[model samples]
Target chain A: MSENMGNKVSLELYRTQLLARYFEQRASDLFLENLVKGTNHLALGQEAVAAGFGVAMNKSDYTYCTYRGHTHTLVRGAPVAPMLGELMGRECGILGGKGGSMHLTSVEHGAMGSYAIIGAQLCIALGSAWSAQYLGTDQVTTVFFGDGTTNIGTFHEALNMAAVWKLPVVFVCENNLYMEYTPIGKVTAVEHPGADRASAYGLDSIIVDGNDADAVYHAAQDAYARARAGDGPSLIECKTYRHQGHSRADPGKYRPKEEVEAWFARDPISMYRLRMMENGFTDEDLTEMETEIQNTIDEATEVAKLSPVPSLDIIDKDVWADGGSAWRN
Target chain B: MAQLTYREAVAEGIAQEMRRDNNVVFLGEDIAAAGGVFKATVGLFEEFGEKRVIDTPISENAILGAAMGAAMTGLKPIAEIMFSDFLAVCWDMVVNEIAKARYMTNGQVKVPLVIRTANGGGSRFGAQHSQSVENWAMAVPGIKVVAPSNPSDVKGLLAAAIRDPDPVLFFEHKSLYAMKGEVPNGEHVLELGKASVLRQGDDATIVALAAMVPRAVKAAEILATKGIEVTVVDVRSLVPLDTQTILAETVKTGRLFTVEENPRLCGWGSEISSIVTEECFYDLDAPVIRITTPHVPLPSSDNLEDATIPTVERIVETILKNMG
Candidate 1:
């Protein structure tokens, strides 16, 4: 736990982390039951990183993330029903099921969009930050991606431009040790994929304990303050691990058993729960929050199940602003 | 009315929008102080100042991605990709990100930005720097593609693209930048998806875009002396295509000839031919002939480049042969 974080903020972080954890667990179960179609990238063990940034960020600040962004979207205050419904391909989904699991977006809540392509949102997020800076607004833009994205070209392009322009943006790299099936270290030259490259872009190398919510919150707060104060962009590398596979299809058999168990012992949700208790939170207080989160997830799942599938009539709609895909007029 | 070069109109068009709306900002490499590599965007930096008219590093992906982000937020940005051929460097941003952002989000986001690139061949800059790629933007579902033939259309269409609610790719022909024509005094915004009939005739209809439009018109003039008066239709915008004007002219003349600067295979003319065949199949007096450059990379040598692209003589000869 950090000294700067108040008890109330810590509890809120704990609650958000619990919400993300429970929601993803239900989402996984729904995927197994065939209620969720296509493929989904779950963020089961990376709750602290999402919760930390989510709680610390201002409501107006924009967020961009990769395909594994369910937790990021939830932390931005998007209702779980539409998010799960989107995964279920229902009309009531956030994007009306037009953007499947990989492309979740809720612009109204400042959760810009989850890009399926690696390192794409990195460049896209620059525009939002540029908009803020150009308009003279204090709104900061934060973009999150996995460790694998550090090798992509856009990562370098975006970082260079952001620094040159001195745009108010923060780049967060959630290094979950694995990029899809391959270990990130195998392909990457540097030990810290994101942090190691920060000096080249003239940015500070910020490394955080992503498993600890307080540590993440402090890091996020510092980055946001620097961005708001016109200090350009900051790259923070968070060391975390994902409990599940890259997607629903793989079982992640490539990883050794000992590594999985060791990561499991330092589970973000369990660690946060213990931290809350150490901060004078009663067992009843924590249990009550957990029960509430479970009920919320249960209700969200039911709502998603009841939501109807999108109709074929809208197949050609929304292609243009006029609500029709008419190329020749 | 004022006579302006196509390159000067590029600057005027952007300056007009920036003057009207504070949200309108422009960015690209050497665009601000240097006034663009082609010198087409001259005076934008001086008039709008450094904040509104910014310069960027040579990062196509970042340029377009940042434009998309700015457009979605509040600012209406105009990003220059230097050359249309360089769009390949940022194809993912244009095709996967900018083009699909609106539809993928179910219209929750609106990317109202313009990507201005110097397109087409004529300067003999070689295949890498001189390929015509309007068809690339046209194939994308959400993007609006506009290619103007003359200075007046450049100002009008560029202004219209800036005001459009969707992402627009404004293709300024590298060959026509030096050409001069009369433009309206102020705020000349033309509607997209509308073709301009440069010359009217009943014998035959010649359709062209960008650099080909002037060549097609010259071909019509030469054919007029030979008593073969053909209607010249300048396809100003490709996406949201003016099919009605194209079909009407084709049906009126009972013949259609497309002068395309792009390569032979799967060019914009192919789509026009298919549409005409489906709609005006019976109205045609002869098969639709497309006067196109052969499928090959544009060479740097002036002789090879001129021979590669469809010339005024080629259009005239092709039409004269096809009329028989």
Candidate 2:
């Protein structure tokens, strides 16, 4: 935990972490019931990284992340009902059911977008940073990706360009150790997938205990400050673990039992909960917070279940700014 | 009116928009100090300065991704993909990100940007550097595809594309870069989705785009000597196609022949042929013929390259053979 963080900030982090954890839990349950259609990549064990960055970021700063971005979107203050409704493909969803779980976006809240293509957002995020610099705004752009993305060409291209231009941006890698079904270490030449490559781009190699919210919050603060101060980009690698399989379909049978157990023991939400109790927080207070999260999740689930599927009229709508997909005038 | 080369028109078009709106900016590989490899954007860096007219590393993904992000936020960026063939290098950024951002986000984001690339194969730069990939852009939804034939259309159409609220892929034909033509003076902006009828005749209507327009026009001239007068229609924009004009011209002549620089399969002409067949089937005096490059990679050799793409002689021969 960082010494600079106040008790109030710590409690808020705990609440947001719980909110993400509970929302995903409900989402997992809904997926089994066939309520949430298609595939979903939940940030089950990576709540701290999202929560920390979410709290640390300004409302004006832009955020671009990968498909594992439900937690990030929620942390940006998107209402739970609409987000859940989006997963359910309902008309009242955040994107009006146009974009599914993997592509969650809220431009109004500065949550730019969640790209499914690996390493693409890193390049896209640079544009927002460039725009800020060109328009003379102090707003910083942050992009988050998985450890697997380090091997992709766009990652290298984006980093090189971002470094050359000294764009106001931060690249955060949530190194959960697995690249879909393959272990990242087997394919990667470097030890630290993201951090080790930082020096190559004229950036500091930063690695943080991703399970620690305070640590991530402080790291995020430093990166954001540097970006806002026009000191160029920073690449941070958060060493974390995902509790669930890559997606809902996988059972994660390939992993060794002992490795899974070790990661499970360091679950971010539980660790944060215990730390809160040690710092003058009661079990009752934590339990009350959990109950509040449960109620919010319950209400959001009900609203999502009741929401109607998108109308057929909107199928061709939004293909252009004219609200029609007509190719011929 | 000032006579400008197609390459000069490109710089003028970008300069016009950049001067008019502060939000409009230009970036690409060698586009700044080097004035673009094609020399199309010369003097832009001196006029616009470094902040607005910027040079980027040879990273297609970064160049386009940055353009997309800028467009989504506020700026109307004009990004050059040196060669149209290079679009394949950053296909995902162009198709997945830039094209679909607006639709996927339910209009929360608008990518008001132009990806200007030197398209087509008259330079014999081999298959890698030369390709008329406007059809590739046309196949994708939510992207406006424009390929200007003349210097005048280049300036006007490019201005329209930059001002458009959606993403536009502007294809400036490599062969037409040095071709000079009179450009309308001052703030010229032509409406997209409108085809230009460069010539009028009653026997047959020839539809062409970009480099093929000049060939088709020359073919019409040569065929005129043989008493087979033909109307030439330049299909300027592909996505928001001017179907009404195409149908009107085809219906008037009662015969249609499409001349395309793209390969035979799924070329822009195929779409026009399908449209003409569906709407003006009864009005046709003869089968709608399509004159296009054979389905093969453009060869680097001059003779092979010239034979592959539709030439004036080939267009005239095809028209003469099909006009019966």
User: Which of the CAPRI classes, incorrect, acceptable, medium or high, describes model 1?
Assistant: high
Q: What is the DockQ of each candidate?
A: 0.87, 0.87
Runs off by more than 4 Å, candidate 2: A1-5
Residue-level lDDT for A10 in candidate 1: 83
Off by over 4 Å in 1: A1-5
In candidate 2, which residue pairs clash? none
lDDT of 2: 0.93
Candidate number of the best DockQ: 2
